[model samples]
Target: MPSLWHSIPALLLLPASISAVTLDCKHIRVDKQSFDLSALGGPKTVHQLQYLQPSISNTTFTIDICQSLKRTKGVPKSDECAGGTRVCGIERIYNQADDSSTTERVIPIAGEFSTSHGRAMDPEVTRLKDSASNSDSELEGLRVELHGGKWPETSGGSLQKAIIEFQCARDVTGNEGFEDAAEGSMLDIKSYGNLTRRAGEDAQEDDDNDDDEDGPPELPDLDKGKSLQFVSYKPDSDGVGVLRLNWKTKYACEGAYDEPPSGGGSNKTAHWGFFTWFLIVTFMLAATYIIFGSWLNYNRYGARGWDLVPHGDAIRDIPYVVKEWTGGVVDKLKGSGGSRGGYSAV
Candidate 1:
């Protein structure tokens, strides 16, 4: 017989519910505040965002939040993201001698889609607090981190990560408006690269250790005017490459937190309390015991009427027993005493 541990992998291979993905923006709760971004995930559509880098390999990062991205038309499904992918990064490498690009690398940064052979980590969601906001009591922004993306062993051992921040910008309409308003700060992406080299000596050394030309990039802090842009992509010492992006939208504003739907109250999910569950279980157990016992009595001894019920005598006497006990208590309270201080009869 195979060892029990050997079967563990088979057990893990069992079909798992698709909802295991880390973040579900539809019912997100942070610090007692709830948010619903289900609207952003259009029907059979994903909210797509793209970032381009022309210098090092015509690299493009196409991403979607809250929904999987669809493959491009005329492109083989294998060339793009697999089904259920939320973040996909493509790098087209051009030949140095000829201006034509001959090679392409597909990097699945983050996604919920998985296969029997492998599964990606569910997206991680966190809160980003903005001290400047007046609603300091609630979260001012949201941070979503995706994991389970790994570079080939030949490329590097680091797992790819994507961290997207949604900041509150009440004046902005949505991602589209934010993207348009962010054109001025596009140059910051290159400045951040220089900053990365100066940030730490180890990062420079690590870059040389790996042949990947497009080493992990980094993002600068949110600029004064930019509403949407790349943040950073720095590989950690522990072999994790993180790509960060920021998007400002009114939907992330404080007013958006747990706002009731128009023309209706919030539909809070009702749950039974501990006592309620306990009573239900107790009743079920009692009913089961009584039904089983009655069936046994009927079949085994031909019992009828009250005799068919187990402990029927004790149950029938319960009312009388309570009455007698109540009467005794009342008599005791009245006191078996004679007139004045005379002794009471035994």
Candidate 2:
């Protein structure tokens, strides 16, 4: 009974350690369905063309973050984030619903920015402290790049078009789901302040360029949270950082192959099949002629083995013709052998 009494205090302390933290934030969505390589009206297949099903990995999310004029400790400041209330840090909070719980430190703003096309213009979705992504899973980087967004020491976008690559196993492989690298495939992103407008006429269409020398372009970063302009940064008003991601996926819908058979190979096979038969017939005809000639010689002329068919009459007549030309009828009557012994009296 005394030991059971000691456990009462320990059970009561559990609730105090794990407190429920409700995050006051907004969600900015960067949808993927809008940016499709095929819909852009160009040569769709490139970079070896390995597509995936229209599932989770096919899409990416981005959010622009802005910092307020009021300085938040550890949050960096930038020219684009000047004079307004903006987002300071991006914190990924975890609650007690899964196997484990973790609250990652807020991703600090780097003050770097890149310009890209935008579509949505929901003020309610943008002006909050929280953000949503294309994926709920945590991914390290882009599959095509084998890595994710980078925080370089400059502010600009790569002029080269980015590629969105799909990741799926071979047809023979049993694994069908994209959940393995799903975490590393997702984009945990932040960007400049909220978007003020939807995609406009000035928005540039996705560039279409498959380099003749180099390979295809890379997929744009989903978490490339570009800083935004702000009127002022106060207690509530913060600068915005916009996230823009470009992902291209390649996948088969139903019956397809990695390397479809080409006409060149097919054409070669067709021609080769015909010529092989032609050669066989030619060889057979030649053999038949030689065999028949030997048979005729053996049966009609009693020729020995390996002897050519008789055509000796033509050779014997040649000398007769020559003798007749030189000695007239006297030599011609005895054929080519006439008077050959000793200039015979005849």
Candidate 3:
């Protein structure tokens, strides 16, 4: 026959039937050409730029700035730009060349810009014409730089600060373009908009109110033990998702204190009651034994007297003799009486 311990395996198996819920995080995209930088328009001149590119999920990305050789001061170093001066400025670059050089030199374009304030500014694609003649091949590397400056001041101001953005994508030309070939090759663009230090301040204030609205952590009841169990599940035929956890009582003090008594009474009360009952029963038994013993002795031997006497003959049966000198004196007295009668006869 199976014992009670055998049923525990089945009891433990009961909680395994519970199902577990799955959670996943995805990359969401936003559609907005330029983030507003008017919030940053103040006494301090603010230069803003935005760009877009592909980003690995939950990772920090690096943005690069590339200057076109057409805009440089020498012969064309790269095919994207013609022979010109290569000028890379943190912010603004002045174009002082003549009309011939200006026609030969391609204009320096602005890259994407981002800041810690979570705002971004992307390049305006409509401002420039597409010069890529090849349609089928991929555009290996493209760079853009952003310059901020005022009309009058030449240098040394907030305009001096500029952000550059870079991105990599397939050349959109018609020859070998992924779209033309019917392959689902994706073109990912990462964007960094202009950000101000004061961005998200209102959101932070709302966050403070939310913090105050949130309640305190719930306290577990110390009285009852909670029974909980965890189970694993397979979401797909390949058995990809699996989880494990312990099944046990969830009493707040189970691990902290001694086990409570089975009875409802407090420990001290139970102990005192047990001792009292024990003493009462012992006293009763002792009293009963004393009374029963006295009754038994009275019934077995009543009050009685005992007598003792001697068993021997009387002393008068023994014989005795007188001394010989007393007997001679009696004989002399009789002879003297006879001698007196003879003297009277003479």
Candidate 4:
């Protein structure tokens, strides 16, 4: 009979069934266009938005496009969702009688939260039709779908999902904390219906809200915002939760990532610096002089050992020469021999 240890090797050899999910915000490619969102993902940065319904419930959505959100303090890695988590939602419901609040659930809306194998399905990228295009023939926005988040137990057992829409904004940054005129960032709430309904309505509302010819729409403030902002969260008939967000950044504009060519004959130029050229020239000159001198010493004088090297005597006496020079400098600094008396030297 085989021992249990013998069976462990076979299990170890088995291939993993899970697939890896890649979230490269710096290089999000959609058709002919590419987006770089490295600006939003700063060191120790988490873009968060809060929603509160007075005396009922409050919710907060936290997201990071380039990396996993920082792990919660004092919480074990296993207990809190950290690795492979791009977007998370935490909802707290308040008691009607005493105004006491309890956390309803913490949902990892977008990302793979597996402790063992770090893998997930590819995020779905699609072209979105919005007011920016104005015509149905041209789609002006981008949509990214990320799912496979660990579902809360309250739901039968379905993975959490999130959809992010990239809309063009004139401003580079949307954070009110960073910008003076900017009001707020996001709006997180329950979805009244489908995503299309909200997007279509909001576009028309923006036009109506535009007070000045050159100024932005007069929209209400939510909180200090980022390029990515929460829109709504709705569960399907099967109780699977889906969250939506709107991203407004210059990167969403057409041809934002149309980079110039990087090959030869381009207008761009690259040249060695003065210091680099100096080092190269000095090294070549020294090498050539040594080679020529060494050959001359070998062929003309039949030199051997250290004699074959150019300036071999000086090179070999470097240590002794330096020692004598250092002693002389020290003696000079010491002022002729210690002092005949303590006050003899000034």
Candidate 5:
């Protein structure tokens, strides 16, 4: 005879399945990370990364990806980062030197990257192959269309699931200290080439033209409250591959952000500022009335000025009383006052 609440946990533990299509994507954090490199004799280039914050429309990320390449087989290094693709999008990368020096740059956003291979002047990566050896490589930009919602507008966004596809590739080096150790390194790369849906409208839509349903829905805007699932990953074993990433970038504005405590950092006495000013003004006004009233009565009413005023009778006799008291003191001091018998200075 357990209550309904007691059965809730049991039901939740029961094996359940969902048919919703979930997108898988490599979770590229919004921070600086180790830059990716290509095979041996790869161009000496710099790569950039950046993300479009919900508040910003454009951003810039500058980096100096520095690695010293050595001459192999008595051959001078010819091209730097010559045969590789540098993926830059929707993020920023920071390369900070130990001297407290930092380089910042913005990466490309959605649909903005160079798939072309081995051009000397790739916008994403700067090539200084011909420059002096040990010269720092500067990554100027990885420009692309930014996707994100605005603050306050995108706040409390709804959670959504997206099928993201990404390819993870890293440079693997065998010789720890060869002439071109970093470049000659070979690592088995994973690629996510095939994208599968739940066989719904997203999978059936073939025409990229004006159709009710396009291929897969665009990525959800990057938000703190949104959910992203990388649908799959494919690795490339031999040839170099592009590390493409799709994220949840179109979140519905429905989830609630952790609002600061309703009355946090607020002082209960904040209104005291106004209250203090009010008291000062009231006191000043009262003082003013008192001072001005005395002046007016003296000037306008002459001898009868204080006659009608509060406690005016006692105040009016102040001069006469002071004079009488003064004379009495003088007479007593002289030992001539009435009923004073002692005249000797004892």
Candidate 6:
């Protein structure tokens, strides 16, 4: 007879073979741009800008803005931008004349790009709106134009880079409440390409379709007296299925299918059995400790010991000397038995 441990190798091999599915991936990247609005006669306000990708559903992109410096103890630092809570659309003029001198805002730029499919494929672009919105909040939008081109073929090589450009306006309100505007150019670009050939492609291509039907009719024999039978099935040289044999073996081994077998009752039962035994063992140990402690305590102080000294009858009849030394001595001692042994005055 074989031990249950003998089946572990087969069990391990099954999952490894089943988990070997291949996947395809696409790569994308975005670059950061900086813009200064102070050139428009407004307080030199700095804007943190990011271009956003479009959503799969929507083809529009968006720009988010926020105060760059947060006010700390009323002191403005060079690196700090204006801090406030408000998310206005990109069209809304940021940096209006407020009480504060130093100001900053976060802005997003969004538009669409075309994909290789000749159909529009918009990537999601995300940005942070102005400060009044949560400091960590991000504004998301889609590209304005659909990505043009077929999914770039990766057979030759990975995509190198793609570029796009647009125009942006920076409008600032001065201390006198006069607004000034400056137009600057915005450029957005991304690069793609890093492709590998799919695995198992050659094997799939070489399968013999004509001989598939004329091949042996594979069937399991019920007449085979079952001790523990191991079935070994292997994919053909072309990565196809071929039944080898059902042999009498000490361990019955099977491999994992593309999908896992659904009967999980045994696993649940084993978990419950483990928990039940754990609780039983825990309670038994606790009870054993409690009983052992009670037994030890009873054996210690609860057991009586023998008296070492014996009292004679004559000694018992005689009056105690401590009793005779009473009155004056007792009074001087304040009736505390004069610190004598045995007799105590109450």
List TM-score per model, in order: 0.49, 0.16, 0.13, 0.49, 0.15, 0.15
Q: Tell me which residue pairs clash in candidate 4.
A: 21-120, 185-225
User: How badly does each model clash, as a count of residue pairs?
Assistant: 5, 58, 35, 2, 58, 51
Tens-place lDDT per residue, model 5, 1-346, is 1243354354344322111101111111112321121111221212221222111121121111121122235432231111221222122222221212122322221121122311121122212222233432222111111221111112443211111221121121211223343532211111100111212223334443557654443322222221222122222363222232222211110111121213475432324445865886676565455445554665676524344243577868999999999999998876654444655546
Best by lDDT: 1
* Local accuracy of candidate 3 as per-residue lDDT tens digits, 220-310: 2211221211122112353222212111211111111123334554445335545866886676565455334434444564311111001
Candidate 4 per-residue lDDT over residues 128-164, each given as its tens digit: 7533445522646677788767565434556678777
Candidate 3 lDDT trough over 10 residues, lowest sum: 20-29
- lDDT of candidates 1 onward, in order: 0.58, 0.28, 0.25, 0.57, 0.27, 0.25
lDDT of 1 at 234: 64
Q: Higher-lDDT candidate among 3 and 5?
A: 5
Candidate 2: segments with Cα more than 4 A from true spot: 1-266, 309-346
For candidate 4, the 10 contiguous residues with the lowest summed lDDT are 184-193
lDDT of 2 at 278: 86
RMSD each, Å: 17.8, 33.2, 48.6, 16.3, 30.7, 35.1
Candidate 3 wrongly placed segments (more than 4 Å) = 1-139, 146-166, 171-346
Error of 5 at 68 (Å): 36
TM-score of decoy 6: 0.15
**Cα lDDT of model 6 by residue, 1-346, tens digit:** 1332254355445434433211100111122322221212211121122111110010111111112122335543332222221111111111112311122322111111222112222332222232245632332211111111111123432221111111121121112111223211111111100000111222234344434533222222322332212233234364322221211211111111111224553334334445865886676565455344434544664522111112223345456655666555768777464566766678
TM-score of candidate 3 against the unseen true structure: 0.13
lDDT of 1 by residue, 25-140 (tens): 66667766666665455312112121233222444566666777775667776566667667766665433233344226676776754562165766656567734454642657
Pairwise TM-score winner, candidates 2 and 4: 4
Output the better candidate (5/6) by lDDT. Answer: 5
* Candidate 4 deviant stretches above 4 angstroms: 1-21, 42-54, 75-82, 94-100, 114-121, 129-139, 153-155, 174-221, 224-227, 259-346
